[model samples]
Target: MKALFDTIKIYPKLIITFLIVLTPLFTLSLVMNKYGSASVKSEITNSMLSKVHFYNSTLENEFGRTIAIMREFARYDDLDLLSNRTEIMNYYEQRGAIRNLQKELSVIKNSSTYIQEASVHIPSIDRTISDDNFGTIQQDEFDALNVLTNHFESPFIYWQDRLFISLPYPIKSNRQPPDFVVDIEISIPLLKNALLQFTNHTAGNTMLVHFEDGWRIGGDEPEGFLQAINSVIQADNADNAELHSATVDGQKYLIAFEKSKTLGTTLIMYERESTVLGPLDRYTVWFWMISILTLIVIMIVSYSVYRLIHRPLRTLVRAFRKVEHGNLSVAFDYRGRDEFQYLYTQFNAMVQRLQQMIQEVYEQKFRVQHAELKQLQSQINPHFLYNSLFILYRLAKKSRDENQIRFSKYLSDYFQFITRNSSDTVTLAEEVQHAKNYVEIQKMRFASQIEVAFGELPASYVDLTVPRLIIQPLLENAYKYGLEEKETGAKLTVQFAEDQADLLIRVEDNGELADEELIANLRRKLDVQDAGLETTGILNVHRRLQLQFGAEYGLVIAQGESGGFSVTIRLPRTTSM
Candidate 1:
């Protein structure tokens, strides 16, 4: 078994695995396609039947309500009086009765959404008054309506291409016109609109058909199609709602119909079978195509396994071996438009990026070490120590024990921090404390000449990490160069402020001798690209900050608004170093 498995390589294994997986899937799809298509057809039929029945019920309710309203209006005493001209003997009496009848008709017309106009016809007065028109209707039009009233047995009648519901329905067996008729013209447009809502999203047609009168309405299809549908309904003679399939003009259709009991009309909704089953038919075709193509693909993949997979894999393994041996220049070249080509391209790019990153890392390490050495060399100044010790000595000699002890402690902390050389960065709190210590020592020496104001450090920024000894040098420069000229009221301010982008630590001295030329010279020195030229002082701080963060976050030196030299150390607003 082991030998057989070992002898069968990846090419045959892949083909065997794909066949095992796909054969059952193909069979399953065929079975599902048969059942799924049937399910879809059944669902469409039920949906269409449900929609048609709903719309039919809606129309029946509307027509029934309108008929009820007309019947009620027909029984009004004013209509009875107006029906008999002899009862209203005078012109004023007749006019008043007709006016009252018109008012009632207006109210009834406005009450029902389906009532386009409510009218009253009086045979004795030889006039028809409607809510829409106060004048009499045409005599010939009235004669036509009268004829329909006697002809149609249903309450709903079609006369002169208009639909109406007339009161005093179920005409007498004598075929004689009644004393007065209350005719409510149905709003065909509104009815059509209601019917259209059912088929708005579907490729279906809706029609309202009156079989007895051969009246068809509310459809946009051709008259021949509608006539064909009418013939089917007539031949079936099914009064109840039903869903059926029929063939019309060489095309099959799914027809859903419901009969309106009140109006004796049928609402028929029909759609082409293909329209409903198009997606399923397309899926069936696609399934067969995919099955055949999958077989072809199995053969194609077996052929390509050697050319696409085997060769590229060998090349990749060789390239990896070269890289393992420190040969980073190895690259894989594949020109075919396939996944193997993408893999080879990415491999080449990764190798190139690895080489580039190695060089960057080396250069960055060297720069950091060089900057740290300069910081160490510049911070360990003998002159500053001499001044601090000398100040301590004078204080001890004067028998000021408290001042001596305080100065000694500040001096100890300051020198310990500068000499430790443990880390390249410290918290803002530590740096600010160190700067404060230097300020205190300097204040002790130059108490009479200088007045220093050190702003409180914000608690939020206390933990921010920054380069070591970045702030102290600025204070040193302010005291040594800025406060040297002023004797009285020589204010030196150390403030911390922050904006959206950077944290600013400013050192300003009210030196009257400082001018634009000095500020310009200092700015020029900061902009110098030659890193080896200036390794200490403000230049060192600026370069170190730029290297740590980015070039945008370093230093800004300008003349103080009042009269002094101000140097601001701008560091990025970040939580970590």
Candidate 2:
């Protein structure tokens, strides 16, 4: 019971923080993924709607163009005058009328497509001795023509075996009576091609299939072939009768169906679906690509955000806890020189200074404090001597053999650096050696519990001057926070390398980051200098680096492989300060 209470007293906030942060992160990940998938689906749907609109627009354009051409031909001054004449009761007596009709037919036959014949209606024709009214010979043809004259002038373009338009014009009767109606049938193949043009595909074998009559308005031969056009409406009842399906040959066509506004008959347009949607089918492929691209973008953005914000914050929190637990010299490692590097430096220094103060006032922890009484106490910086002595003391107690002798030598070098703050610039060699001393003392204290690996430092690069104790404090941090949690032996790797103009020092350990909430709490405590409870070694390094080298080079923390952490510090080879 006492041991559990003490453990709780030690890491109460840490337990709470781990539960809080982990749960929220998992929730955030799920929400983002769900919405991200919805966004991709919406984008794909919008693209499909656009394609539908495109198809409709194309069909409308083809119809509009054909209507315009028909209107243009109808508006000719001569044709209009002949057709609009109310005074002409009969037309066979008028030579001028016949000539005008002949001329209009010539123009339509030559200018229009699939137009085999074109002629004007004549009411009176006594010279021929033969007459055919609306329902006499071909009632369906006459009715289809009546549609063009009455309704929308929406003439159906007929193609293939049983397709043709019924165009009705007023014909005149001679000495007998008044008005007469003549039905004009014309071929309509060119118009089919024009409509198909919008789809970017060809109209193949466009024709009306019928049993006896054959392909009516368009196609080769004179109604020789026949088939059933599924869409071509054919009927004969008491009130109406159309040229029903004619049987000349046998074959079936699933033709396109269109209604005539004027004649009340069905105009069948035959063409295959593949022929219409083939070229534009590539758009479907592009649509698929767009969907795939959106998914990739969402995945990438989610991953990047996780790395930039979530991962870093969590790492700092864990690091902060180590510093919280009196690990003032905690390692704060990161890759690339960013704002976090500065943060790492501040955190480590603050914690270390806080720990040193705790040591200086070790009596305060178990001793008394008065709320009203003020006591004058001398402040001492134990970092100068105690750092050396603390290492030796711990080593002497741990090894019990040569601890006193090894620590004595470390203490002498420590004083030499303490008294002589003269040479601000030390060779890379000197910095490397100084860092070695710090690590060796810790190695002795921990007693084979921390494994230290040093990268080879070139002799020629040793003459470079560096801020004293730079690498030592960083190494101290790795031991303080990262390696302290090791079960058996913690591995510490130090590398001293120079690029074109900068020296890089890296310290790594096989320890996971501390709890995030603890890091934040400790940082707050450091700023407040919350008695001897908070660590602030990172703050000390931050200030010292700024005081010695500009405001750039400093500590940074990173969660490396297997959740281990690393600390990196960059120092310019020729730092002016």
Candidate 3:
């Protein structure tokens, strides 16, 4: 898996990542659309139910108000006084009573638009007073009124052919049967119109179901829709006030119901499911369209990025691989005016600089090897010259020629000592022997004018190796620069001592020129790091000692006792000779 991902290009990687993120977002949008659709349908049904409840409440209030008005009319004092038979016996009193009753009924009828008629029947005179003259009552009308009187405090209601909602108030004298009945007839058409004004149903039906009498107030409903509501009303436990769902006429609906216990009526509001959730379906379609467009846009952008960025970066990666393999000559010459172009230009310049550095390093190594070969050849030439001189010195010694013998021996020994350059380093004893040979030669040249002495070194320090020709130069300098200038013969002494962890070899000479100024001059020259061999001959020996051992093992020049110049050669005490 890891290898497959590593081989995939940058463009594919970005597209894969975008698709992975987009998948979950698309799923969440679909889930939200479904949830929002259900929520919208529920809210619409609840809102319609709220309006139905308002209408029911208004109906209840109107019914209560009408019943109260009827009770108020029953409290008339004239009706209470008419219980006496004497008031109906006198012709003048009877005539005054009938006129007063007519005027009161007229006033009651005029008080409300819902009241169509008002009338009072008296059994004693077998006569009825009314707010309007509607001819005469038939036998069937009288029988219906007689049966309705039996149900006390009930409204006289019927909806077959004609509509009526009347309240019958019976007047009882001295706890006997009612002396007469007062009826207030409410206009059914006007009441139905008033109830319909509160309805807001778009599809489906709204009804005020009077369950007690099996009559509904709202007009014009489909038979199936009406049956569905009536079935729920007839069901014993259908008093639940919450909105519910039902199917009627092969169509889905959301139903909301509220039952009024006081009026024995139920308020039912319902609308078709498809109609209520119609907008949600439209919204879902729109959301899917937008989502598809978004995916298309992402695809277009991914392709553009692959061309502009990923392709150039891949080329840079290839260049890096070449550099890793030591090929600094590789170059990237991307030509467009973008960030990658600038980076490629700089990278190509860097490769050129790296190539130059590589060439310079190779040339430096060649020069170093040449110098080492020349140094070896130079050592060989000196060894051949010194061997010939050694042979000539033995021939002179055999002849017993003192001057020639002395000169030949010293020259031969000096040449042999300096020319034996098999290596740059030798033991301290060998270095000291070379120094004594050079001093003897110098003594022969100066006669008894310079006296010289050699001191014995410790047995333990004799085998330490040091740079050859280091001590002989100091001894030669003491004779040519110091002892030769003095009138009295100067004493030259070579002494060895140990100071701390080093072997100190001191060469001191007492001469006229070995004063404070000469000692200071010699010390100053030894202190200089870059002094050349021709300018500072003694300083060259000091620098070689330092390079061979370390900075601590070097020559230090100073003043000795009673006008003598002392040069101390410091070397590390090492057992590896």
Q: All candidates' TM-scores?
A: 0.63, 0.29, 0.47
Pairs of colliding residues, candidate 3 = 449-489
Q: All candidates' lDDT scores?
A: 0.79, 0.50, 0.68
Stretch of 10 with least lDDT, candidate 1: 144-153
- lDDT of prediction 2: 0.50
Tens digit per residue, CA lDDT, model 2, 1-577: 6676566532343434444655576467556655655565455334333433443344334434434444554455544444356356355535454455556546545554544554333333321101221112333433444343323433443333334443333323443322233222334445445434423224334332232323243334343332244324433222221222232333332233333333333333433434433334454556457656755655566555545676567788988887767566677655659888887777777777887888877555324222101110112246545666676666567756766787677656645653454554466677677677766666667778877788987665667665455566666666767777786857889877776776677777776554455446544543442344412355444444544566566555555453565556766666553
Error of 2 at 40 (Å): 62
| Two-way lDDT contest, 1 vs 3, winner | 1
Comparing 1 with 2 on TM-score, the higher-scoring candidate is 1
Which prediction has the highest TM-score against the true structure? 1
Candidate number of the best lDDT? 1
Which residue runs does candidate 3 get wrong by more than 4 Å?
Answer: 1-15, 23-39, 80-113, 123-128, 147-156, 163-177, 236-240, 300-577
